[model samples]
Target chain A: MQLALESNAFFWAIEYLATFCCGLLGGLWAVRKRYDFIAILMTVWLTGLGGGIIRDVLLGIFPPVGVSNKGLVITTLLASCAVAVVYPEVDGLKWTMATLDALALGLYAVNGTQKALMYHTSGMTAVFMGLITAIGGGLIRDVLLNRVPSVIGDSHWYTVPALIGSVLTVFSTRAYARGVLSFTGELVCDLLIVALVVCLRMLSVKFDWKVPGAIKRKQYRF
Target chain B: MQLALESNAFFWAIEYLATFCCGLLGGLWAVRKRYDFIAILMTVWLTGLGGGIIRDVLLGIFPPVGVSNKGLVITTLLASCAVAVVYPEVDGLKWTMATLDALALGLYAVNGTQKALMYHTSGMTAVFMGLITAIGGGLIRDVLLNRVPSVIGDSHWYTVPALIGSVLTVFSTRAYARGVLSFTGELVCDLLIVALVVCLRMLSVKFDWKVPGAIKRKQYRF
Candidate 1:
């Protein structure tokens, strides 16, 4: 499974695209916060690569690709520079930026689950890893800025799709391992899961769908 | 160095003690925030073990001791319970708790440096790892609660001691590796570094020492 994923150029393309999008998002966030240049650059890199680094470290993969991959590092720096220069103009493309962000989230979820399964972690752990990969960077960014992580504090449907995609990926991987699903079948399944997550996220955002908070007003009792 | 540290039961004892102290601090913070029992427990575990886990993961250590070691996990839980039940009483020992916390910070710094050196990381990386090990847990805890990490925001001399200790540890380890220092000498040096950090931290707190912020009043320009 690892070999198949590694050998697939499509997977690499998606991963890089996700990194770039995440970097851009992070850079924009830093700019909005009025952070200086160095901080903006660091924020971009962390937001783009933090999750993968955390995942790789957990799996005992040394010198995580975030730091080791020159291309990805360059991508983040480029994102920093781009956001720094194009801050005002980019505001007009909010929806476009958000769509890309959603795609990145889905890709990260798929990639994290694949990596966890490759490391031979249990299905439950793999799902957890996937969720972390998808949201960890944003979580770190929020924490660094001293804000409650939106995933934890907001009533958004962000984590739900990631969780669902991860579970589906694990199931497909299991089928592939058991020879009930072919390599191509597994890849297709993975792509579909990503699509499903992106769709769910986008729809939720468009329709203002929300996850219930710890206490709904109707359920509150003095 | 790795073999020596691993073989010495004293190293393990200090590491566990540091973990327990960190857990207690984290639990106290959570309780103060009025978090629920589950959040308090999670906070304790993260505060106690987060730094070591991050260090080990960065060094590619699988199943970090924090999660894999039953004893350490139990220690954090014990800390959680203790803080929950003895919150008010613990406040009376403020000075004592602060002293222990300083010691824990120093020990974490030493252990992180040692582990990074064991993995053949460069001296600079080792020092960085040491700082991370010493303060990563607190940073994570602060972030979770939507506050700026004290290490970054507070004018206190918290991180300075950890940085100094890490740098000193690296230098001593280098000397030891060059055969200029005996095994006993190295161990003594590590203990002295820990002591130095503890003293520096405690003294800073006692004297209200401060790290300069981004702008000093005299240097401020409108």
Candidate 2:
């Protein structure tokens, strides 16, 4: 039990730290557009915490964002300052932003699913939460920036990958929780699931893949 | 009882229309930013649906962003095209945007309180929901644009006024629902409440009122 608790804490640290990194990239991206300082900070704050905030809030919990709690505030501040100070040193900020975004999406997918299932939400709900957690911030950010949300646009299976990852995690953990799978089996399963999501996301992007939208109309050409 | 349902539906319409205006501003704003057609459409969609999305998600309900079903997509396209076509001819777009934002805030406050009360949540929760519903979208937008959130940064008494509006809405509403206040009386009360809220919010901006944040030293700041 103690070991499990420690593992969870370690997971939290990685998740929060990843969130901060994502925020830095997001904030720096906005700054490059010469958006006002306040907007920059808010973007960073939103990208950093938006997914977790949605996960927690939708679970009927008080989000750390709402609390403006210390750990969250500090991590974001560090990331924001880093971007402000070091943005000059990066060669391809855009690429870095995209890379961090992918990493953030992967981390949030696994972590969010774990959290939801731990709270005993069903598998379907857990997967939904994972997708929401992975894409929610970006959706919010894109909407705010007035850009086509990456998830909803010509998607490279972005959302579906996250959904798959979360569903896999839930199934593995469900077996372990029910004493059907060994601990080692669950761990391996979790790693494999994460790999699947990350690989699929990368491949889809590399191959220019997409899920077909419900309608494909070239309705206006005149 | 039937009248109460009608009245609630009426308030919901008010909320929906206000959101529509916000969406229209977003579309027009996107055009000014020189976004592609799809991007313009997404921006307007976000503006229209962003706040309410946050409101419902935080309330642990299915987000109605996609709930308008087919109309959600069609209306977004229609509003975007309308704004794109007319924004060029529209004078004082900024003023219109600001006015719509203020109006949205008021309606969100009222709607949030009413919805929460309907769900049987605590009054305090209802007030918090109201404030969040009002500011969540623009805040999300500012963050994505990498600007300081208007409400959190410069707008003093911004969220506070929303709270006042929400309190009035729910309080008078509870009275009417319990038969302590006559239906006609409650109607008068509700309108008075909305008027007061709008007045307070507009007045705060005019007078440079502010919400105090915890002391932050930018020397020690993000």
Candidate 3:
């Protein structure tokens, strides 16, 4: 009945926090874009909940956690309100957005991988799904607004951190060998991985770490 | 499919022209938004085929027709290039875009409905699928690009035209069921519906026949 016995509480708590962080970041993003409070709320809610809905739908699950989870909804609203009131103090919005977004990217990727493993998916599929889950909501947000997606663009360590988190999740799950593991151990691994991804992404931002190859290419028709 | 003769030929042509129109519109929209050519091309490709790809993937098919169909690829590229080159000379692009977009909406709606029917979906389900198919790509495009969706935001007959076209398609298919009309007759109905939608959209612009119903509802936190 349960995928991982000890993780039930951890998953829910982290999911709630991720939604909060994502919503806060999304609201601040709207501020940079000069949206109204309502627009900001809508965008934040979408960014916080959209990827989960999409993943659930793709898995043929109904109600999506987004629609059913009150915590996510309330967190989005709270984040939107916070951004509206406190945004004046957050100077250098671009840098703030990037830093917070990097943290979000790591958290989401780790969470996505965990959730996908719960669905009994293989390592490769779980990794890909995790990466998608991390960035998918933002992808939906950008694409719906008719802008290019940041995940697919040459932004700073956007997909790289997500990929790292995903890989860590897949390996950790495998290392457990689908068997039992101590709750504390699992949490320790999860935190270590998240911290690693965040640190790696931050360093990537500082030292220009990239995928080692042509991350960007342009093609034209004559 | 083997559902009806000329099915392949019809969809082949439909896919090409639809991609062209959508891609061209996407390119022009990017020009208005001040993106580079690659950005424009990416948006165009997404607007042209993203919806159908989602539909196919949801249907449990691999390598979605939208991707494997090279006609769509070439059409998307050519149309985006054309728009990029000619957008400057295309005076009064707002009105022009409105009309062309309306036409594309109708055609995609009809085509999407037929695709659903051929897949043996119930009429009501087909209608829902058709609406999603018609607008899903554009919605994704807008959200990714950090802009408001035109269909949901603009107090125009955007969804209205697509709804009308889908309804007409259902009726035409029903008539086909009764042997009251030939497939050619159905084709004729489709063409007429597309033309009618385009004309109505343009006339609405010319005469200021826009609907103002949802404007109040849109007055929210944003």
Candidate 4:
């Protein structure tokens, strides 16, 4: 059965956009890693859909949106191919990638939190899933490419923004549910969360505000 | 809610054993990669419980057993620490590792298939999930460690054995459902599938039967 998307069309639309951005980034990664065509395609699929799949699976939604949503699958594929074709031009535009990453992070964080709440998950779980949906695909992509996940290393405050966005989504949505927040207020909350994340991400990138000491020389094996 | 396990005591027992094996392997891998204590612990948890988590999520079972089953978590942690302690002594025994890997593969394949069938999944999906359960954790471990997944590269017929076991489990269980196979016959089928996989794995290891040209030099980027 299809996921119940009628109730949150706006959120899902953002999710799709985020998915495409992740897909393109994955393709870029495949190029950077010098992987062949098949590997690139596989990476694209994994990166584009991995987070949503993780979210859906955790929520006990069968035949995950990643698997059943043909439109999304095709969109990610096309995004991947397009990025692959334009890799040379895009490779030099570091600012563009950073912007896209921030935007995707914001979109995914909000969308993921909303979906988790829809499934009646606890607020804590919804926040966790929001982070997963925002960053899980890129983690998988990096892992598959045989690199330490950037999020755990040189992420430069990547997760903090997502976390803030997720927390905002969860608390605001709860307020709305309890009738403490108006519909307009709820809509503002959503936009505000997204804006906060994107802004935080851009500021982090500009300022290089990385979490210190997370990068350590390997010791104490096992 | 907990998974429906009342009808499959034997399967669950084997699954636990398999989980222990994977946890140990994860510990060993972490050691090989020279990760610190916390990273090792994370690896152990991921490798031990990741597959079951994936399976349960796909089947729409929320709050996965990995999160809910405290005993399993403790068990995996203990298993990982034990492996880490004894790794130097065990390092010389290559055959031992191959044997354990084979056994874990067999156990997970059968357990995954049975769980999928319990959920009334299509045979194809069941088989796919069975393979996922059997290998997904290892893939995660390798990826996190920045290596190509062994199943994709150096596995030497890994998927073949898992596929065979999964296929047998699905078909035999289906037969049992139709009353064409007696309960005793179904049990035999289960045992046979596991045995077949383990044996095939060992034989492939002995013969060093790598898949034909699945390995290619990375050339066509993006």
Candidate 5:
């Protein structure tokens, strides 16, 4: 089955929408970290586009779409500024931001996997590419903010849901290619994966579910 | 007349040696950060080869040499283990590490710029690529360790010399291409650039030279 957002204009809109939301979260994170406005701008750009750059670079795509696309750049900057301006009045908007961020993550995870599959990368590689696309920006942001990546820490199941969604994409794509799944079936699967991630993330957060690490927490103490 | 280390076995040895040194530093950093053994291994891999992965990816080189080169991988892991075992005896080895790291940085900067020029990238892009190659791993390392990148902050003049060396490479390569500079001249220029960077870095450290940032110290207070 054909991917619903692969070549559609609506996909571009959704991608930019996701970019804006991600940028907003990045800006909010900077503000909370007490970073200056310049740092906020840097964080927004990094968090909004870092994943795409990494995915494309790994796939050997030159001048990564993130770097070449002016619209994405503008969206990231504008969204960051808007977040900064609205942050003080949005004291109770934490859940709203988290929900939106999760949705964006789901979309990006699927999209990254699709691109990797299109490049004929292995299923494993596609899954990894998808995870990077979903979490890369945040990793860059956290690193710049001088912290271990949340995805690597004993945080909520951020990488897990992205991994699942990516695996689903690869599986669905392969099935579609073999005539086992129709285009409509593929579309349904895509939607289902996104929904699954959103639900999984919210549940993980609500229940305070944390991934167990290899080492005890005391070892992390410096 | 030739670039002494371009394709020589000795060049390969130096590259691997640099890899070992970088990996050792990474492992030492993990020890200081109170990270577990697994994290030390991860950091070693990241710090030893992260810059080259980034450089090649930006240049659209798939699988990154760092990924494909098993020798480099083994070197990083082994070096990390060695450092872990020898950490206690190396408490007084700060200058030794710094000098070797500067050498690696110079080599990487020049090599990255040369590669970019070979690919016909613009001079400005070549400079940026070179700078990235030289500093990228450390930037990643610092971020993972929960600190701002020294290159971005008012630290030693790490990036400046790399920039100068990169510009020199681009200019010298262009001159050689135009037949204005002899092959020997180009080789000499490359060596000079690397030497300049190494000396400048050492002097900067020795003299405690710092590049002052625009904002005052108080502004950085959270």
Candidate 6:
């Protein structure tokens, strides 16, 4: 399973696509912040590769691909430059941005889980790793910009889809390992999970779905 | 050098002391934010071990000692509990907190550089690693709390000592590698670096020193 996934062209495509989308979003964020050119470049790199770097480091992968991969470095730089050049025009394309963000989230979640599984981590750890890989970049971006991380504080159902997708990936991999699912079946399952996550995220955004707070919203000052 | 440092009781003590001081700072910050018990605990862990975790992961160490070491984990938890129980009393000890924080910064900076050197990294890389190790936890904490990371935005000289200490560590280690210094001299060098960083930090705080901003105080709206 590991070897197959490692050589799969589809997996590589997914990774590249996710990195580009996340990088674009990062660029948009930096433009909005009015950061300098160097800072914008840094932000894009952090946003696009931060999650994978965290996951790889935790998994003991040295010199994480985020820093070592020349292709990824160029992609992030390009994304930042694109934003810097035409931010006002790009900023108006809200739907396009949201769609790309959702796709990146789903792709990252699936890839992170699969990578963790490939490294022989427990199912629980795989799911956790997937969540980190999917959202870690955004978390770092928000932190750098001095904003509350949406995953923890926002009402939107951002984390739910990623969590579900990661769990599904783990389950499908386990099934494949047990010979309960065929090779093609596992691939199909991975695709399905990505699609499911994207749909869930988009639907939540469209419907303004939110997770409820622990207590009823009667103002309680600390 | 790696073997000697690994076996040094003094190195172990420095690591533990840094962890304890950082953990205490984290706990205090969480309490100040009026966070719940669980949040406080998480904050403490992140603040105390976040820098080391990042350093270890970047260095390709698995299951970072931050999470894998039972002793370190227990120490962080205890620090959080202490903050929760007597935050008011502890809060008044400003001088003590500042001193401890300075010491932790020095210890972390020195240790981070030495660890990178031990791993045979270039001097430049070792210095960068040391800076990250000393400030990464506080950066994480600031980000989680939705504040601009002091290292980037504040006027204070927070990062100066760490940077200087890291550079010095690299130079001394290089001297030892070239046979210009003995093992005992290397140890002495490390201690002096730490003391130098601590004093620099403390003096900066005492004198209210600040790093100048790029632009003069003039209203410039984006």
Tens-digit lDDT string for candidate 1 (A1-222):
553455588877777777877788777766665555655665788899888887877676786767567778778878887777776555558788888889988988888898899889999999999998999888877778777777888767899999999899889889988899888888888889889999999999999999875655775687
DockQ, candidate 5, vs. native dimer: 0.17
lDDT assessment of candidate 4: 0.76
Model 5, span B1-222: residue lDDT tens: 244347578767877887788777767777775555555766787788888888887887775766556788789879777766676544358788877788888888888888877778899988888888888988877777676666777588898888888888888888887889887777778778878888989899899898876676665655
Question: TM per model?
Answer: 0.60, 0.53, 0.56, 0.59, 0.60, 0.60
Q: Cα deviation of B178 in candidate 3 (Å)?
A: 2.7
CA lDDT, candidate 4, residue B1 = 13
Residue-level lDDT of model 3, residues A1-222, one tens digit each, is 233323578656766766776777766768888888888888888888887776666554577777888877888888889888887654446566566666667777777777767766656556756766777788777665555676545545666677778898777766665556555566677778878887877887888755332112234222
Error of 3 at A199 (Å): 6.3
What lDDT does the true structure give each of the candidates? 0.80, 0.68, 0.69, 0.76, 0.79, 0.79
Clashing pairs in 4: A60-B60
How does residue A102 of candidate 6 score in lDDT?
Answer: 89
Isolated chain B TM-score per model: 0.93, 0.79, 0.83, 0.88, 0.89, 0.92
- Using lDDT as the measure, the top candidate is 1
Q: Which stretches of candidate 6 lie over 4 Å from their true place?
A: A3-5, A37-42, A53-74, A152-154, A212-222, B1-53, B57-114, B120-131, B134-138, B141-146, B154-222
Residue B34, candidate 3: C-alpha displacement in angstroms: 3.3
User: Compared with the true structure, what per-residue lDDT tens digits does model 6 show for residues A54-158?
Assistant: 898778777676755777767886877776766665567778877878888988888889889989999999999999999998887777877777688876778
Model 3 lDDT at residue A57: 60
Question: A1-222 in candidate 5: lDDT tens per residue?
Answer: 345657678767877888888788778878898888899899999999999998888888888988899999999989878878898754467788788789889999998998888887777678768988999898888877766866655467787788899999899889878889887888788889888998998899999977542233332333
Docking class of 4: incorrect
Model 4 sits at an interface RMSD, in angstroms, of: 5.9
Q: Considering summed lDDT, which 10 consecutive residues are worst modelled in model 5 chain A?
A: A213-222
Please list all clashing residue pairs in model 6, or write none if there are none: none
Residue-level lDDT of model 6, residues B1-222, one tens digit each, is 553344588777766776877788778878888889998898888888888888887887777878899988998888888889988877888788778888889888887888888887767668767877898888877777766765656546678899899999889888888899888888888889889998998888789887542222233233
True contacts kept of each: 0.31, 0.06, 0.15, 0.29, 0.29, 0.31
Q: Name the regions of candidate 2 deviating beyond 4 angstroms.
A: A1-13, A63-69, A88-97, A217-222, B1-222
User: Which is better, 3 or 4, measured by TM-score?
Assistant: 4
Once superposed on the true structure, which residue ranges of model 3 sit more than 4 Å away at CA?
A: A1-48, A67-103, A110-132, A136-222, B1-6, B35-42, B49-103, B115-132, B135-164, B182-222
Cα lDDT, model 1, residue B193: 93
lDDT tens digits by residue: candidate 4, A1-222:
112222467866766776676677777776665555445655777788778888887787896777557778777878767776777655567687678768888888887888899888999999999999988888877777777888887769999999999988889888888889877778777878888999999999899897776455668554
